[model samples]
Target: MDSYRNSDARPPIMQGSPPAMVPPRLDWDRPPWNRWAFQHIREILPTAEVWRGTGHRHRLE
Candidate 1:
């Protein structure tokens, strides 16, 4: 895995001016653009808060 961590590694997609190589688009369903879009879904899609409550913790089976 260390071989994949080089100087040429893809930089994190950030807000503001778009990075080179990665195409920019409003539709996140496409490739490359979807990579950043999916990672930042809260920024693009409508979201709501779900209350889990401070009750007993459920164990996963």
Candidate 2:
């Protein structure tokens, strides 16, 4: 879908080799920027892996 986009949404914001409308570091949670920021958070922010499993099982009700 290289040439397909949803008409309801604004044209692509951050994309391409250099990307567009790169939101400021302090504006990711604000209007206009939040739309894209919230969608691609993993790529924009520094993150660490979390242990989501019970490493040691214990008897519980």
Candidate 3:
């Protein structure tokens, strides 16, 4: 069971390399905050459902 124990205690690594990039620190009034908010608007906002807006139909004749 040594292998199993080691696997559980090992730190997570990305292919033994450092993280691809570190996200910038967040400040409540900084652009990073606004940028993050805009990108995640769907999660924070109570959006209406998007109904079927396309008219494409199957033509299997």
Candidate number of the best lDDT: 2
lDDT of 2 by residue, 1-25 (tens): 3445654567667557475657789
* TM-score attained by model 3: 0.29
Q: What Cα-based lDDT does every candidate model obtain?
A: 0.69, 0.78, 0.57
What RMSD, rounded to one decimal, does every model reach? Answer: 12.3, 11.2, 11.9
Q: Work out how many backbone clashes candidate 2 has.
A: 0
User: What would the per-residue lDDT of candidate 1 be over residues 1-61, giving only the tens digit for each residue?
Assistant: 5565675767766845554433454667578678877777677679889998999989989
What is the Å distance of residue 45 in model 2 from its true position? Answer: 1.2
Candidate 2: Cα lDDT at 21:
54
Winner on TM-score between 1 and 2 is 2
Candidate 2 RMSD to the real structure: 11.2
lDDT of 3 by residue, 33-57 (tens): 6665566656555677777668987
TM-score of each: 0.41, 0.48, 0.29
Weakest ten-residue segment in model 1 by summed lDDT: 15-24
Which pairs clash inside model 3? none
Superposed model 2: Cα runs more than 4 Å off: 1-21, 55-61
